[model samples]
Target: MKKFWKWTNLTESNPTERILTLNGTIAEESWFDDDITPQLFKSELNSCSGNITVWINSPGGDCVAAAQIYNMLMDYKGNVTVKIDGIAASAASVIAMAGNNVMMSPVSMLMIHNPATVAMGDHNEMQKAIEMLEEVKESIINAYEIKTGMSRAKLARLMEEETWMNAKKAVELGFADSIIEPDKKINEDEKEKNKASDSILFSRRAVSVALQNKLKSHYLANAGANTGTDITDLEKRLNLLKP
Candidate 1:
């Protein structure tokens, strides 16, 4: 069976910071499958110590598996940092809520919606399925509420609407702490250079506007002297003032 998670130790000597990559579907096998059971994952997790950085890029699968993973992370002793580099939808979003510090890439997306299942039976069976789904939805809202501090009713409304959020929106909605940026360090010189560039751009636009206003005033003041000039000629003169 294909495993959804891969582990990498960042430092050989310290082994304090580990990276856990969860890609693709959360679980392709059944929840009880021996090869990909959450017990096996927990064993691997318990083998290590210190901080963990989880990188997730999944479309979501198997809500039960996701719930188990979320619980495992929450129970871990080490600090957990979750970085979503791609889409985290449906069940995957629940797992993300376990992070002590959740972050998303600028282009990453997060989606949440009501749980769904198929049922083939009479009206009684259909009602049973509906009740089950309602309970499952409430359980999901519990996770969202812990992370966002939003009211259960509001969260339920968002889930019912199938809310989608970009990195900025996720931070705004309290679903994520912040958006991830490049790790490279910028020196003071580079910072000043960027500031200078912005100032120069602003100054150029200001100069262009000032020149256009002056030309307009000049043309209007000399209107009597230049009766042959039409509005078209004045527009052409103003166009030349653009940088």
Candidate 2:
């Protein structure tokens, strides 16, 4: 699901220190199919007109979208800090690196991977795709090298491996400045509650019956798991059957 960009401040009365949060896949179009524009981000920064903090939690998406966002952030004059609340993968990682100071949540993730593309038809099409991908790779590599002060070659290798770095690892690599530890007790309490809910739901007789049939027939036959249509149908049936 695509989350909306949420804006907030540390304090209510003194709201000069603005925060813009980017959560979910950083695609050309959001999961809801809404178009993303550099103008929208620029407008947000302009509205803040103070020290800005960008909170990132994304799986990354279009290179063009990433590039536009990167350029906008780099151009902004005020201090820009990035707090990684969850995962910043691919282009989202590029945006995170633009921050003047990058902070990561203790349990958050940062990922980088080589650029990929799909092409059809002849040799020319394949060659064009390769060239385009190389350019995209260079752009992404430049962002990491500039932020982390790491060697381009080294960054390239890490990206090639599709590295998934935890908060501590990100700080060690200079991709993040510090790890922000949240209230662990609160998180643990939430987890315990969620576990109880899951246990109760999964123990239901109807759920067990559905799972058995799914595992034996539908899931076994379709090993690859084509989900959308069948899942929607099942959900509709279950909803209709509910008293």
Candidate 3:
């Protein structure tokens, strides 16, 4: 059975954080296949106790599997932080809602739309399929509402419109808590240092200008005392030294 998730300890010794990477399609196993089950996922999840950081990069598949994974993450004892490093669409977005803190890479995207399925039947059977899809959509919206605190009506509309969000838009709409900007602290520190350097440079320039003025005044006074050098020559010499 193909596994969609991989677990890794972030640190080798006395690790305090774990990483769960969910890439590609959510569940590769056939729906009827029991080889790769949520129970197996749960066992792996419970193998260790630590904060979990889930990195997701999926186009989504198997809503049922996604739902089970979402529930398991929600029930986990440690804090769950979800980082969307690529696109999380459809059912994948539902799973993202399980995070206590959801973050997205600056270039990552998230998409939501109504659930779809193939159905071949008479009018009555077609109606049943439609009804089932509607119910599934509502179930997906439940997860969105819990995460975003948006009204059901609004969430439904967004799903209907197939809303797509970048990291900034996701944060603005409460779909994500923040953007995953690497080296943010280091960038901020660099900015502070640049500001300090600029201030010092400005101060040095001011001192240089003040000293130039003082020297010019003293030279002018000396020229006046000597009364021999032409005033134009003295002015030209001072101008040559002007900053």
My TM-score estimates for the predictions, one after another, are 0.73, 0.69, 0.73
Per-residue alpha-carbon lDDT of model 1 for 110-209, expressed as tens digits?
9888898889899999999999999999999999999999999988977876777777778877899987875888798875654312321113344556
Candidate 3 per-residue lDDT over residues 1-243, each given as its tens digit = 788889997767648999999999988776434645777899999999989999999999998888889999999999999999998998899999999999998779898888998899799999999999999998999999999999999888788767777777788778899878676565767656533123211122345457767866776788747657665675678568643
Q: Residues 125-189, candidate 2, lDDT per residue (tens digit)?
A: 98998999988899899999998999999888787657877777788888889877576556777
Q: RMSD, model 2, all Cα superposed?
A: 12.0
lDDT winner among the candidates? 1
- For model 3 the local lDDT of residue 224 reads 48
- Clash pairs (backbone) in predicted model 3: none
| Pairs clashing within candidate 2 | none
In model 1, the Cα lDDT at residue 185 comes to 80
Please rank every candidate by TM-score, starting with the best. 3, 1, 2
Note each model's CA RMSD in angstroms.
13.8, 12.0, 21.1
Q: lDDT value for candidate 1?
A: 0.84
Task: For residue 7, give model 2's deviation from the true position in Å.
Answer: 2.6
lDDT of each prediction vs. the true structure?
0.84, 0.75, 0.83
